[model samples]
Target chain A: MLPVRRSILGLMDRLMSFHRGSLWVGVVLVVIAPLSVALLLSMWRSPFPINEMISLLEDAESSTPGRFFDPTIRSWYRPLFHLTLWGFWNGSGSLLGGLHWFRYLEVGSVLVLLLLFVSYLRPRTGLQAAAALLAVAVMMGMPGFRDNLEIPVLMTLVGMPMALLVWMLLEREHRWWYTPLILALTMTAIGYKEQGLVIAPVVVGAWWMGSPGARRTTTAVVVLAVLAYLAMRFSTRGHWALFEQDVGFLFGELGEDEAAARFGERPWILYGYSALATIGNILFSEPSRGTFVITDHALSGETRPWEWISIVSSTLMTALIAWWGVAILRRDWSADAWSAESRLFVILVLALGASGALGFNYARDRLGGMAVPFYAAASYFAVLSVAERAGAASLKRRATVALVLVMLAGAWQLRAVGTLHDVRLRAASTHRTWITSPNWSRVTFAHRPRYLSIMQTMTPQGTDPARARRPTYPEWFLALIGGG
Target chain B: MPAGNTRILAWLIAMPALLCAVGLPLYESSDVAQPPAMADTFVEALDDRNVEHAYLFIRQGQDPNTLVRFRDDVRTGGREVQVSPLMLAVAGSDDNTAAMLLSFGARMDYPPNRYVVCLAREMGMDGFVDSQMSTASEVECPPPSGAEFPLLAYVD
Candidate 1:
């Protein structure tokens, strides 16, 4: 008994030792905590247009491998995303299970992102490590705009992080084989989204700025890959004319009538403002409405107080973050810090701008993938700047200041999360009101008998109009609402 | 102080704060005690064009004559009409008088759509009056879909 007691005590002491315990604790808090929250939040989410994603997935799953690359079948070239969804669906055993698992994948991507940030920081000291963890925590806990939290948006959300991770690897590795490796990775990224094509320019910039050693080889490889990707993309059904028409609308050269004739009544201003508002929404405004309300509602020459507030606050916050980042860049002139900071900042700005510019709508989910890395970089810089300044103070004072910063970041995260929670609850209540209320139910029942039949079918794909007579919701949806 | 100790101190401070940051919201979100107001529900229903639910809210305490007239007006109208009660609420209509007049333009079945108004009045604690009690008025259809009716324009 005495021997066993001493052994237990010894084990406890060893476990609590600085290196092992602290590192494990950091992993749990930084990675596990955020992931758990994401999982929990995901469970609360109801399907937003689950039918469209299921249809697309079904089509992809049934098609031949070569068909995915065919432009006539799909408007865009996103084979990897489609394949991933198909794989997930096949593994999940059921359609609803697949969707639930997809949310877990989204949450897991965030964990991967946090780890990437930690690796990027390469914390040597305990203070730096703490800052890295805090930055990740703040980023993970920050509320995402509600629109981005939906299932279909997870494709973009997951793809962006994967691309960034690959980009980071490309930048860090210096082997002779890296040029070809980066080219392959770049092709993979583009397969996820057209924005993946931006990786080519990013590679060029990285090579120009710091990787002069392998400049020619890297540039040649990337250029070749870009040409190949373009060839493959253009070979698909949709010609470059489709892209040209979009560009024509973006520049407002096409009149409203012309634009409508080509692509419905959507105006160029809608796309421009949506892009601007994506950044604005992230920096300011509540997660619930975002800047979408501003563009949609206020565009008719009427304004609300909250709209003004969203615009003003978004502007101020953006400026503040930029100013803070620039201040740190000026103070910390270390080549490593400067290169990393500047590269990330440029990527963030360009990605956000380009995404908004190219897309027809400003969807929060579309912005979310880019926003994750942007926020991570911003938080890292802010923490690093503070840590550098704190080096001047006494150890105790510095520790105290660090604690305060962590607390403040935590508090900010709390407010954001709390708001998101409230918004989600409100949405659920609204959905319930629509579903259960007498008048609302009557109209839905009468006009949308097809909805009832679809709901009753429970099948995500291969529903023949002649055979499937009942309106059915997905089994997963029923399970989500505690009915299944 | 030792460097290790300083690092330990920093982790100690950060971990608990991080836990609170995520855990607090998680804990708070579990409590689903408070449901949204009926007016909010009505507004949502109206916005979603769930006419049956909207009617339920605006049907309370309505005169039979008014109810008959409202249905007759809808049935007789050639074009589809959409009333936005949420828009009225956004425009600062109180619980007692939140309403929006909807204008129907020229559509497939009807060459010219007439104007109809949906009004919400609080009926004790139950909910709003049903759609039958909601006001309806006939007006000339706007030429273009974007053109607004008098009441709807004000609400917008």
Candidate 2:
């Protein structure tokens, strides 16, 4: 054979190899492709300390362990999330420095999540080496992935998905310490984000599907764990700071009295609306910009060019994913009552439900982070299933079509990442401009003067032109930005 | 035991699962208020010059970097110009609106902002231009295209 053909075959041999060492190497190879793209497109720069201001202030107010559980200090209780911040704060000595550490951890977690997911899929789904890499790339390329990676405080957004994959993997292992292990996992997830409560249902699903031996004790533990969590959660101040004045914010111009009057008796209506809208935002490419929701965008009948592109690409991708899912269920129905395909389908549905329901307070793109992985896994299975059933002649044709859809979705996701990167860069720029302006002192302090002063002191003094314009990654990395 | 029973079990758990999902946020949302109905479409309350609304909106969650067009009535030369809130604030000479937006991280790097810089120079709002330029000496504007843009129709 020619040299090029020989090299190609050799690489394929290595990729298809199941050697213990190479398996890990293959997983790393798979992770790097998507992680590199994500890093280049979204997280190549340090972010402004705007979003993490409250957490930093809370930490400053009390360097005590008790503050983590003090729900009155913030809208909700998130100890593990704050603890991670506290670790960074003490280690890095400034909010911006801590955020840089967070940026690194965010990417590191993504790498770990992908590694665990790829390892899990290898045995269960039997995806080819190349297909596994592609699936991970497409999953990480989802629009919500950008939001998950860029927002430092929203580390739990990424963590919850990791927890979901962990639960799925753990269910397969009927170890002796399963009860405590699962209980610990559940608590850790809840401590990450309020939405981590979704993991409880996941635990229940696992108990139902997995071994019957541990059911009684597992059920007792899960129930006790959930009850304990709720007891602690409800005993708190019962306030979302976004709508309260104590945190120095109000939902738009609506005061607490006005908000209470509006959503008073039937807050469920608002919650339900937000939940549905959040789900719609995930599945369909509905605009979620500024104060605008999909309804407003629809009524206005005005969409930016990129918004239209997102809508078309996302709607088509959703339709394709749904079609592929139905095809898998139909094909696998005769195999078993609960085949691997069916179980995964069930997981996908549950995850989507959890993602939407998590938005009961309000809908944001990051809320849908948990669902994207399952969506990507389902797509992987669907593609493999189709290719598996096709005759040799038709295989190439089907693969090409699937590849095209993946490419389109990938491009759309990159656009979303680019937009996020632009927003962050602008945020950094505007922050520097604001601090340096003569009118900086005259700026209103909606939160607290102390918090603002803390922020001002923490902000890097004097703008470096390079930092203002764009982050200075290595020259080779800079070259990847345009290609990304 | 049976497949059908498992399906039943799934349904049984779903109700509590939902309650688990919605219960916590709702319990905490006892004092929470809904966003304004027009909050979605109206990107900014600059048309009404409602500085308080803008202040709260930015403080709460609205991205100040979002570029919104000025209302049609603010048409120049009988046409609507797609202007950033910063530019419109400068145009109407609302220092409070400009200052509030700027402090909250409104961007001046958008392509349209260069036009705003020129407009600021033309209007002799030198102070506004000076604040935007951190290290620059003077405002620069491209020659006008003399194009007439149409008015944006009011959305119902």
Candidate 3:
């Protein structure tokens, strides 16, 4: 009994002890969490060719490759986005297969974020690992992540952040040729979404902090990139608007013209409110229904049973980060205090602010998608810095208790996300509200009658007209597990 | 700094520019042809109560589930309302038109409320509503909230 006890203690001590190699253990945990959740939750069973997804595919099928580059064809110009739709349609062999590929890509982008966290922070202790795990759980709990998972059109949610992280990771090593490489990334990010410009300031800030010799070249490259991005984006003279004007139309309260007139009266005040509400939504889990309205949701209601879990966990984690920030400011004023981790936390906080600022017309959880990953990284780093400063002997005692509590919080949040995801999946499977919802009607092609013709004829490539059906999860689960 | 980095750098610079040069012209020079004018005629057929013409339009790739906005001048004080073909058919008590739509995978749950079923029952189309609402025990009707008839729900 004594020998067993001694061995267990030794194992615990070794895990708690700081080492560079142990960071890889955290990396492994990060990788496993998303993959396991995706599989267990049966995320790939999403309904395809519904809502805007149907129109996107139909447009992809109808349009020539060159039409994607033509700014006059669409209200917004995102050639890469258009091309991605084309690629997804042609490459996947079927509409069902296309949905599967899209799910994989979304999951893959999120995994890139997880790996980026590991690469950036290099968390060393088991407590740091738990913190990262908790951060990921919180990310999944976020309404933005939930919205993106259900709606593939919001690829920019994860794509924009992934682009930012990739640029940040590369910009650290300032070789002469890296300038063009950064330029390419910038262009591609813009090609993905216009909000890709949001990443520019953070990248420039990072470059400014680096070696003085490289600063001039870095600044020149970023400036040139920004100029080029602006020229390319605006030169075509596509339908350009700073904000979505159809607010009342969105809420089903007023006509489009009436809504436009109302919003135009005090656009600045409305935009400011949208931005702040979005930021508040991301940090404290406060519901913002100004832009994306979710009906019959816990987030929208006054308060519900499990709503407290998301609110409490998110608020607690943010408060801890704030506490850590103050402690760092007071105690560690040296050059080392503004280390890579600290600098990144500051940059991400800026990026979160920028993301809110980009919520130009209205506040929606989906707009916070780019910031959520950064927020997660900030949470991870704060917990890591706190644990590192605490020393191992003291931390080991407190970490165990914290670890258990974090695990419980993480499980509760993940369960909430799963329940919500299941609800979306059920709706998607039925082919009812998923296609006919007012939110979907807001999409560019939803109202077009010609496109509606194309939508009805489309099916999984090999499916017979009689047998072509979107199977609900129970049907899939029964077949797999119960041998139905 | 490294040989591999230089090779990657070359590819990174060349690919996007090349893609834009080759891809842009192809997109800019070409335009997508419009789809055949089928839906307008289909809507017209439904409006005229020409079940045969509507069936022909459905066969010619007109989706029965398509919701087209029309002026409800007499019914709703001149407000435009979006209605599916099935709803139009039900409102007119055109059983053949309704049956044809249902046969071609038109969903009965398109109506925002249970008022459509109430309308069908009033029209003596109990068999059609019964077949569509097989799962529900009964159609629970609620009082209409607005001044206009509930079936012609307002649209912006």
* Two-chain complex of model 3, DockQ on C-alpha atoms against the true structure: 0.03
**Candidate numbers, best DockQ first, in rank order:** 1, 2, 3
What's the lDDT for residue A327 in model 3? 64
Q: What share of the true interface contacts does each candidate keep?
A: 0.14, 0.03, 0.00
Q: What Cα-based lDDT does every candidate model obtain?
A: 0.48, 0.55, 0.56
Question: What is each candidate's DockQ, to 2 decimals?
Answer: 0.10, 0.03, 0.03
Query: Candidate 3, clashing residue pairs?
Result: A66-B26, A66-B27, A67-B27
Q: How accurate is candidate 1 locally (lDDT)?
A: 0.48
lDDT of 3 at A251: 28
Top candidate by DockQ: 1
User: What TM-score, over all chains together, does every model reach?
Assistant: 0.56, 0.62, 0.62
lDDT of 3 by residue, A1-484 (tens): 9999999999888876644446645553544453334432344444443556666777787888888887766556678877877787678886556656666766566556656655555545444444555555556566565555554555565465455464455447566766666666666766776656666666666665552223566557777878876776567676655465433122233334564566668767666777776777777666444532322354457444345555566677777677766665455456444555555566667767877887656666666777766776667666555444444335465455345344434443443344344434443443433323222232334467656554554432211221122222334332221111
Model 3, position A384, has a per-residue lDDT of 55
What value does the lDDT take at residue A185 in candidate 3?
65
Candidate 2, position A388, lDDT = 43
| Residue-level error in angstroms, candidate 2, position A451 | 3.9
List candidate 1 stretches off by more than 4 Å: A1-35, A38-50, A57-62, A87-104, A122-126, A141-147, A171-185, A211-219, A231-275, A279-321, A324-339, A360-365, A390-411, A415-484, B1-156
Cα lDDT, model 2, residue A299:
62
